[model samples]
Target: MLKIGPIFNYLQDMADKDASRMEMSIPQLMEKGYTWVLHRYHLSMIRYPKLDEALSIRTWHSPYKNLYSLRAFEMTTSFGEVLAKATTSWIIINYSTKRPMRLDRHVTSQYYKEIIPFEFDFSSLSPLERIDLEDIYPVRIRDLDINNHVNNAVYVEWAAETVPTNILQSMRPSEIDVIFKEQLTYGEKAVVQTQKEKTASNVFDHVILRESDAREITRIRTSWKNMPL
Candidate 1:
């Protein structure tokens, strides 16, 4: 099975590592009372590789819009086959106040080295109606990132766990969209809910809400295709 965990992690890890090269790392931003938060995710999975395979990632960004920036990524194997491609939305906000802030010239100049065209269109992103599956997820220590909140990628892994086994064995996710609603912290539990429209067997709708106060954590829409043996 192609575990959906590493791709997003690699995407994020590369972001931070690359940012540090330009002196715009997370710690640097945090010192200014600001930190970047992932707001949205869009991934297109073309194929999965086996062990002993290595992949390369190429990422670029669009100009920041107010407080938001759009980034594009493509992951290719050593053979130059595109395995996955993605686009994500990020926002920098004041940590103490939790308020969105505009990107200043100093921050933007850090990583504007190379400008690459966006490989995916943003128009396809549309709101997905909430689906209520009956499962509850508890956040643990391992789920937290450096920010002490649940990492954005953890939401994708949690959603994958809720997927039915029969579907998991036979199908693979071709497309995934994750829209973050709120942040999850330790000691909180999330209510896992999902819905799949009968007319669209390949598409599944997912939502995760904090059980403590019924606050939404995230909403994900995934499209699947038959796995090749």
Candidate 2:
């Protein structure tokens, strides 16, 4: 079955392809001294495909607003059976200053589209009130992506590492919502903290912090379902 980490990579890849189609790919934006960064994601899975299962993925962007842009993705089987869907928010930042820039300042309105496959509230994710489990993972060179920072998908893996073994073995993530707060790079270590939601045993909240200064870098919430027999 597909795992959250790979699924995230697929979503990001599709988004990149769409951006390339608009002449806004990462390399293209970097040449203009700007790079798009993912801010938030809300992904729900209807089913995870088996290994070697053929799949089709589609992604499109919505109208840009102020400093942010919206993108949505859908994954399906050969017959168009919906397997997963996601909505993401992103912002373009000046590569040199590392600060967000107005979308219109760089990207023209011509690239914006009104087609939205789905909607997800991008409200701030709440902080974890308590930690039920914690673990530490050292950043490795292999974890870095093209931007030279820890890949967004690595944060999801770090958070999952803190989940209880029983839950990891018995349940599959049905939905995952994440907010990226800061960038992590090689030679750093992440402190992952996880807490099971009191109201829903199958739901978990996670926070990933930089071990050097205890700075929170990411927040995630995952809803899980029992594995099918």
Off by over 4 Å in 1: 105-108, 117-132
Candidate lDDT values, in order: 0.78, 0.85
Determine the backbone clash count of candidate 1.
2
Show model 2 residue runs off by greater than 4 Å.
Answer: 108-110, 113-118
lDDT of 1: 0.78
How does model 2 score by TM-score? 0.94
Query: Per-prediction TM-score, please?
Result: 0.90, 0.94
Tell me the lDDT of model 2 at 128. Answer: 88
Error of 2 at 170 (Å): 1.0
lDDT of 1 by residue, 85-135 (tens): 898888887889988777654465645555454655542434345554558
